[model samples]
Target: MKAELEQLKIEAFQLLNRAQDSSAVDALEIDLLGRRGKLSTLLARIPELPVEERSGIGTLASSIRKELQDAIVAKRGQFSAPTSQSLDFDPTWPGHSPSIGHLHPVTAFLERSADFFASLGYTIADGPEVETATNNFDRLNIPANHPARDLWDTYYLNPARAGLLLRTHTSPVQVRYMDSHKPPVYIISPGRVYRHEATDASHDTNFTQLEGLAIDRDLHLTDLLGTLEAFLKHTFGKVKVQVRPSFFPFVEPGVELHMSCLLCGGKGCSACKQTGWLEMLGAGMVHPTVLKNMHVDPAKFSGFAFGIGVERMTMLLHGIPDVRLLLSGDQRFLEQFHY
Candidate 1:
């Protein structure tokens, strides 16, 4: 019955659009919204609906009916006699443009990055956001007592059973991928990650991360640096990249990848903390333990892996001041990116 109602609504709108005169619109209004109309017939069946679905179906039916009525009114008004010849305005006219739909900023950014990697023969990998402690931590060379765990405090959906929790990074996808695949692998894992942390303009409890992995014979730190540089240049268009020594359990000789500040043109600003470079990617050669955990012999296969905040890159690319705005459902904020 709900599906029938939805179909009826669509039919009503189609007929309404074909309405060429006030009389035609008036006929449609009565046929679709009158006491004996199609919508009225559906509403009459509300009591016949199942107990749990009654309220929801009725509400949806009501909303559809209301929209149909409004559309009818607006349609009829278009054919009605113009009250005045001055043409200054008409109170009943709808001046607002219909909303256009497009991809969310974060989704757009992820797709853009994925395309870049895909062009280079890297397959996209995926994993569940809810991950096991072993896959999320131990597989990445991070253990229960590892200090790095503190940096990514996360929510556990079921603390008492299996230590299941929301993954704090997309890197877990790499672990899952390696477990099932062998050497000569190239993939990018882009997905939402949860963190039990404070929300700010720059940070959120949940955000997107892009994990990059390339495991081919004779791959080196230079290969990782070059790939990152190309990605940064392709994404930001000629931006400078900096690599500094860093630490991540999953990677040996871990390094942080930084790009010149877009906000200040690398001159330095509060966004860059007076530093010309803003840290973008945490990357290095994959550690041997991580390979062993996934049943891949490190001696046989070596790879470089990196993770970067997708939303952070979106913010930088578009000069968006707040990370929250990327996910916020504000039409005004979103429509600005129609480009």
Candidate 2:
């Protein structure tokens, strides 16, 4: 029994010395000191020996076990030295750069546009995306027969609430703003809007619209033209801007603003359908009925309002090929805009 104990002590020391790593040291410790280990097995046999012999063997076993445990711990420390040294990174080493994020192109445009308008004394205003027909349509002078009111053209929220729908444009904000405030209102509403329409490279069922409204005495089409031209020049950096007579329910003599296409340098392009002009936004003198509906005197005050599609502006600004990409949440597409 003493010979076997001596053999175990020699074997344990040899294994511990050869252990080059923590895993190897762990295996050696388990083999020597575990419940079913060599030491435990030999200890269990102590009762089989003569009473006087058991005491000598047991003492020897305990001493050898403690010596082996101490050797394993020391060996493990030696194995860990290289690992600890490897962790002492050079203080001057260049660290890995962290990943940075940026805003979506639409949001970036919205912020810049807000800043531009703010510089022009236009306060930002907000309203609910879910709105009533009175604010979304009727107050804007859009009637029941208007194409926009059709279920095919708009999203209705509740069948019970006949007029409840997701706002088709931020112009509803203009109505809501006028409802609660007196005239001399100068504000821009930039927000998400929805349409019940098909998706394509140029069109989206959901997009952003920025509506600008200013009401005071004697506002005219010329004033509308000048305000929009200043805004476009600031946004597009001195581009050619023009307003042509057009029609919108909310504007008495509506006009659509057009800018020369940057793609073909105003010569010609598919973007402008072989024409030099790109239809940008709609503006006009606010219709009398719209003011009357909001409890503002149509005779006492007049105004000009305009609506610009933020998605369309973003696409033109970045030369993005698809409107869907603006809201697709594609990190690859968005990472390109990081400044």
Q: Tell me the TM-score of each prediction against the true structure.
A: 0.71, 0.71
- Give the Å error, residue 248, model 1: 0.3
| Model 2, residue pairs in steric clash | none
- Which 10-residue span in candidate 1 carries the lowest summed lDDT? 81-90
Please provide, for model 2 over 206-240, each residue's C-alpha lDDT reduced to its tens digit, 9 standing for 90 to 100.
Answer: 88889999999988888888888888877888788
Query: In terms of TM-score, how similar is model 1 to the real structure?
Result: 0.71
lDDT (Cα, tens digit) per residue for candidate 1, span 216-327: 8889999999898889888988777778999999999899988888888878775676786788999999998887886777888889999988887898999987788877
Candidate that scores best on lDDT = 1
Q: How many collisions per candidate?
A: 0, 0
Instruction: List residue ranges in candidate 1 displaced over 4 A.
Output: 1-98
Off by over 4 Å in 2: 1-94, 147-152, 267-270
TM-score, model 2 to reference: 0.71
Error of 1 at 140 (Å): 1.0
